[model samples]
Target: MTTTAPMKRRAILAFMLDRPGVLNKIAMLIRRKMYNVETLTVCKTTQPGTSRMTITLREDSDDKMRQVIKQIEKSTEVISARELDMNESFWREVAIVKLEADEGRLETLKRTYPFETLDSQGNGCFIVQVTGTSQLIDDFLKDAGSDSIIDVARSGFTAMEK
Candidate 1:
């Protein structure tokens, strides 16, 4: 299957009180709205007492997404919240996929996926790193058929303030 629809990506930024359980509050809102999170990265901000989180949500209409953001801002632990577009901002995610890249297909895989040979010794395992837009990663997986994908770890969406 293929999609001609232009992918809609939104970067949601939140400044929350630096404390325990704040992450849970933020995640609950997304789950309640039934939106699948594409990526979620949280870290401390320059402000000594606050934490910043950037989350990327999968395909959805603008109005519905906006409603979710409003709910996030209304949370008691939330200091501020806003959604951003890729053009107006910059973000990156690291996808580490551990797969069985036997000697027969290593060369072909290197040519196709933007990845690095992390480890190939001892345990007969290899790790690949792919960094790009969500659509690109999604496309890569769709095309990477029958490769014995062992595991996939995405760094989620980490964005800089615009």
Candidate 2:
């Protein structure tokens, strides 16, 4: 017999009223259900007084996901909530990496990864911005080698339906 692992990532898109404490209420509800949020991005929408949220989590069952969505939609501030189909959606993340490298290594790094230099110092240090799928960012860091990396900051997944 073989056991299949549960889905490791799921995304929910929600439209809600832009008001104070709305996020807190939704977050608290999810927390009470014991679901761990992987990434959450909230931003104002084009509609006045409205906001859109993209929340990512790991869930094992479709029923549970539906229950979470229903619960979220019950909130006074929430207009609607639903799970996003990964296949029909596009996802992206942004990361800023600070590293130390010589002039020779810098050119090589640039050739390997598509990134914009945000800042640089004469002392062989540089800060660069990389935007792409999460896997690409991970690969860049892994290939860059840990010893040369000073720090990294990542903007969690932001998604949109196709």
Candidate 3:
């Protein structure tokens, strides 16, 4: 019998107290549990003194993931932690890519990809913004070519249930 399960990507949404050291504590907890985090996005919510965090990682076992959530909820700073169902939830990521290309290539790229030009320098460097799913961003980067890309910054997956 097979002893290992295939690893699957998972996202956990956590609501926690908006105070100092809360992020550090939660990060330490996940780190100690040996889960590798792929992306983490945290921001203050509309509710005063509260914040929400969206963390994406890969895990092979559902039971172990639930156990990790239970452990996280035990923290005084965390209000709750639950896994988000990718099929039932809406998620998006934002990316800013800087590329070195001439005006003609830049125009061609703008027409080919769904990206907005944020700024352009006289030195043929252009900064653009694209917002979509992770896969969309990956495809955009790949299509843009590695030789033309100078830098990239991405805001990890932010998700909400339908």
Candidate 4:
């Protein structure tokens, strides 16, 4: 009997030279590798000449992941590349979840979960602002399962480098 491994989601951070077309270089690499990037964030780093990029993807095997890592390292614009996981460090992501908690149940729902009213008007429901770790967000959503969820939007994982 053979056991198949599940696709593992990984967070990758890369420091690169700050210049035009830098982001394209990273995106192209992922595209070439046929890896599906779940979320990606790019911003200027403290160093004036450098920038940081964070990417999350699901991989089926470590071997292919390693190959992609090697490719990233070889890129002229990329200074360093790293793969991060929960055990190594703390990470968090922000998301905006909009749902209808019912007019009367608003108080009960807010008390049960961490939520801020974004908009409450003539609309049939309310918009809530939420920011936390992925697990926390998922738990909150699960608890709200009994209620009617109007909409959900997620800003994928934004991790802090070690």
Which whole-number lDDT from 0 to 100 does residue 155 have in model 3?
Answer: 93
Cα lDDT tens digits, model 4, 1-162, are: 999886777888889999999888888889988987888988898999999888889886778878888899899989999887657766777767777667766777677767788887545577777778787888777877736676788887778845
Q: Could you give the candidate ranking by lDDT, starting with the highest?
A: 2, 3, 4, 1
Clash pairs for candidate 2: none
Q: Report the lDDT tens digits of candidate 3 across residue range 12-71.
A: 999999999998888889999998888999999999999999999999789999999999
Clash totals for all models, in order? 0, 0, 0, 0
* lDDT tens per residue, model 1, 51-162: 9999887655888878998999999989999887778777877788777757656677667767677777545567777787666676666665446678888788788756
Best by TM-score: 2
Q: List candidate 2 stretches off by more than 4 Å.
A: 1-7
Q: How do the predictions measure up, each by TM-score? A: 0.74, 0.92, 0.91, 0.82
Question: What is the Å distance of residue 47 in model 4 from its true position?
Answer: 2.0
**Shift of residue 39 alpha carbon in model 4, Å:** 1.2
lDDT of 2 by residue, 1-162 (tens): 999887769999999999999999999999999998888999999999999999999997899999999999999999999899989999899999999888788788778879998999769999989899898999889877899999999999889999
Residue 97 alpha-carbon offset, candidate 3, angstroms:
0.8
Compared with the true structure, all predictions reach lDDT values of 0.79, 0.91, 0.91, 0.81
lDDT of 1 at 157: 78
TM-score, ranked from best to worst: 2, 3, 4, 1
TM-score of 3: 0.91
